[model samples]
Every structure is written in C-alpha cells, then in structure tokens.
Target: MNGTEEIGCCGAYCGTCREYLKTCKGCKPGYLDGSRDQSRAKCRMKKCCLTRGHITCGDCGEYESCETIQSFLSHPGYKYGKYRQALEFIRAHGHAAFLNAAKHWTNAYGRYPEQDP
Candidate 1:
C-alpha cells in the first residue's frame, strides 16, 4: 500500500513507525489483520474511524471539536503535538499533500510548517 494508506486515524504516520511491518501493518490493515493482538485494535481513534467509515479523523465533520481527538492531542506528552499538527495539516492540505510532505519526517511524530494562507 502507499504511504497515505499508512497514516493512522489519529494522524500518526505508520510508515515511520518502528513497529510498522514488524508487529503492525499500518492502522487500518493492522486492526483488520486480526491474526495477532495489534495495538490498533484497542485504539479509540481507530475504532471510531472504522465505525464511521472514515479513513481518518480529518474526514469527520467534528474533527476540530471532537472530544476524543482533543483529549489525545492535549496529552501531557510532547509527541501528541505532532499528531495534532498532522491532523491540522490534513484539514488544510488533504492527505496526499500531507503524505508528500511527511516523506521527510524522520520520527513518527514531528513538526511540518503550516502552509501560507
């Protein structure tokens, strides 16, 4: 599958994840694989997206106000900021553009400059 398909519902890039292709196979696929106990199975975002038939939270009308995503993005951990940034990027540019810019992302989470409006 392409890199866009590897992005998690929570905006994590599975392509840059260490567990990807080892213990997991991206968010949707890993959750559906069902052969092993994948972490995505227990992911709240993943379940919510699948239930709503959305590839990512960016597809949701309530993306900006959703409690689940807000909670995740507000975690004390710094890494969650990157997830929030990713979601914002998706909202502004679309998944294809996000994936293209994300190709240079070294960590599973990091900053990407916002596009000029």
Candidate 2:
C-alpha cells in the first residue's frame, strides 16, 4: 500500500488510499523527478514539525498552537479536519495509517491567549 501520489487534501498518501486508486484508475506522486530512496518514506507534516523537535503543532511554544494546524484546517480542498485527523490517526494505527483524526488540548478552564501548553 506504499505510495507516491495523494488525493486526500490532508496529504494522505493516495497510492495507499484504497478508495482513490480504485475509483480513479490512475494517479501518482508529483515530484517523480527525484529518485526514490528508503528515507523518502516520510510524512510531510511530521517531518516539518520534527525539524523543530516539535512532533506536532500542539507541541510548539507559539501562541497560536493551532496556527499551522489552522491553515491546514482552512484548506479549500479539505471538507473535514483531515489534517488534524492525520495526527491522531497515526498514533493509533501507526505510520501505515494516514487517515487518522487529530486530537488537541485547548485551554478550557484557563484564560484565553495561551502562549504555551
């Protein structure tokens, strides 16, 4: 089920997406210009955050814990919070599961304008 192309807006790998490849009959990754390497098997969201040692957007010290997450939330193609879902889904199903739901801890009891968690 490994893949190179994607259809799901949250950057879910469509090559592994049973539904898209089945329905469309054809599709592939965009940047086929580069050679495929073992390390190439990485998630876009996870890689970016990990570069800062923040595995997820929630781990960031920024006031907008959900800033990067929001831009994803506001994507024109995504109907649901699929990007958020991806974060959650991976934990339960592991790397192979790209269709995961995102879970975050918002300041409900605390006052607004939270700078850190």
Instruction: Specify the highest-TM-score model's number.
Output: 1
**Model 2 stretches with alpha carbons more than 4 Å out:** 4-9, 16-66, 74-78, 99-117
- Give the lowest summed-lDDT range of ten residues in model 2: 102-111
Q: The CA-based lDDT of model 2 is what?
A: 0.38
Q: Which portions of model 1 show Cα errors greater than 4 Å?
A: 30-40
TM-score of 1: 0.81
Tens-digit lDDT track of model 2 for 17-116: 3455356432233223334332454545443544454434434455145455566656775433444554444434444333221112121011112223
What's the CA RMSD for each of the models?
3.0, 11.4
Give per-residue CA lDDT, model 1, range 29-67, as digits (tens). 745546545443677887787678777897899887899
Please list the C-alpha lDDT of all candidates, in the order they appear: 0.77, 0.38
Quick one: best lDDT, which candidate? 1
